[model samples]
Target: MRGSRVLSATFGYLGLTVAALFFLLPLLWIVVTSLKTPEQLFQYPPRWWPEHPTLENYTYLFSKMPFIRYSFNSLKVAGLSTIGSVVSCSLAAYAFARLRFAGRTALFYVLLATLMIPYQVTMIPVFILMRSLGWVDTYYPLIVPWFFGGAFGTFLLRQFFLTIPTELDDAAKIDGCSAFGIYRRIYLPLAGPALTALAIFVFMFQWNDLLTPVIYLSDPDKFTLTLGLAFFKGTVVTRWNLIMAGAVISAVPILIIYLAAQRYFVQGVALTGLKG
Candidate 1:
């Protein structure tokens, strides 16, 4: 039994190590290729380290492509969308968690059912809606839908708000607090972590999103980094170096934001997950 346990533990750790390598290998390749010159990019049987490292690929990448414009557009749209998601979701979450409106439970169930329906189903509707509003090819298509309150973010924050004690709500009410006042004073302050987590999620989703941006945005100047990478893949003979550089640039913001919010993200989900 002792020998069998030891073997199992060894294999488990080995499997984990293999999985880690599998995931990290692509990232490593991207970093390595991004640092190489064009001549070294497609060198037979790729080199682990650049033979002659250079930042020229990155320079050429931005120079040849409107990479800075694409990156700026992506950031602006994603940032606005994240703000909208956070505000709308937090307000709705507060309502669901604190108030007892007629058909509240049923409404929540319906909202959850929307999550069950794939985005593909609503894709056409969203497109038509954007077209009617004259928002196509503009940032509005990317930024505006977020204000309507997303299903997942609302549900996540609501669960967190529900886990909060009722006494806090009552205490605020005793101080002549209205519904909005209580939500603003009591719940909003304590619910920072969950809201931050949700904001992070919204930011990452929009930052890395390809489908919506690609479909709605026809102008090259308005392209998001996610869609712009496709252009890098097809443009030239020495594409790998530029492609890798562009990818790394795109991924860096997500890595930084996640690392910053990772602590709160865990607490929000861990605390809220138990409430259900």
Candidate 2:
């Protein structure tokens, strides 16, 4: 049994290491290529390192493009959206997890069903509805929708909330705490880990998103990093090195955010206790 356990552990480590390399190779290549001069970038067999490394690609990409403004737009949109999603989803989760109302279960299930359906199925209708509301070219179409709630975020939080002992709520009620006060005082504090997870999820999703930004935002000044990357491609050719540099820049923030909050993410999953 000891031999088998050790063997299984060894294989698991090997598999995970191999998987990590596979995932990281492309990112590593992008960074290396971004440092290579344009001439070295277009070489038939890609050089692992530039014969002469340069920051020309990143410098030129920023100079010729609105990269700073793009980052700003993405920050605003993603920050606001994340905050809104966390608040809205947590509140909704608390309601469904603790409170009872007519048709609550049915409505929650319907919302969950919406998650199974691809956003593409509702894309056109949503776009037309936004257009009708005069939101086509505005940040409203991007940031405001998240304030309603995300199905997955709410579901995760609800499962976590359900795991809490009911005694807390009963004790709070005995102290003359209103439902709203109980949610604010008792449930919200207890939900720290889960809320952190939801915040990270929302931020990463909105930050990396390209589709809605491209479809809704037209002005170059308002463009996110994803939309700004589009200008790198030409009718005749594209600046591969510069594009990769922009991509590296774009990916770094999300990487930093995840790394910083990784502990909370694990804690959140553990608190949910849903695996069984």
Candidate 3:
């Protein structure tokens, strides 16, 4: 039995090691390619590591372009969108979890049903609405919609809210707590891990959103990091080195956020899945 268990453990470790390398290969290649010189890029058989790595690509990207401004724009949009998503989704989730209202069950079901509809179906209508509001060229198109709770966010938070015992709600009510008060004082505090996880999700979604930005933002000055990165591609040729460097830079914040909240992220996911 001990010999069998040892063999199983060895295989598991070997499998995990292989999987890690498989996933890391593309990232490793991107980092290596980003460091290579232009001459080295066109070599018949590409080398894994750059013979001489330099920061010139990054330097040129920053000095020649308004890369910092683009980064700031992404930060602002993503930050606001994430904040909006959390607040709006939490409020909606609270209502769904606690409130007894007319058509509440039907309404919740309908809201969840909307998730099955493709975004592409509503894309044109939303674009037209934004254009009518004179928000076509502005950040409003990107940020405003998030303030209305998304189906997934509300559903996730509601699942978390459901896990909390109802006796707390009853006690809060007896203590003269209003609906808002119960939500703010009782549920919100208990839902911290879930909220953090949701925030991370919303931020990552907004940060890496390429299609929305590409459709809404036309001016280079207002372009987010994803859109700004597109400048490296031209009709004649593409700058792979600079693009890869910019991609690496753009990915840093996402990695940082995920790593920082990883504990809560796992906890939130687990708890939300428990009752739901």
Query: Which lDDT tens digits does candidate 3 get at residues 189-239?
Result: 999888988898888888899989999998989999988877545521567
Q: Which pairs clash inside model 2?
A: none
- Pairs that clash in candidate 1: none
Candidate with the larger TM-score of 1 and 2: 1
Candidate with the larger lDDT of 1 and 3:
3
Each candidate: RMSD: 2.4, 2.7, 1.9
| Candidate 2 ranges beyond 4 A from true positions | 1-14, 234-236, 265-276
Q: Quantify all predictions' global Cα lDDT against the true fold.
A: 0.86, 0.85, 0.88
Which ten residues in a row are the worst by lDDT in model 2?
Answer: 230-239
State the number of backbone clashes in model 2: 0
Per-residue error (Å), model 2, residue 42: 2.9
On a 0 to 1 TM-score scale, where does candidate 3 land against the true structure? 0.93
Task: Give lDDT tens digits, candidate 2, residues 1-276.
Answer: 999999999999999999999999988898998898778978988778888999987787678777888888889999999999988998899999999999999988898888789879988999999999999888999999899987888888898899889999999999999999998998999988888888887787888888998889988788887677765455215667877888888888988977888887676566545542
Say which candidate scores most in lDDT.
Answer: 3
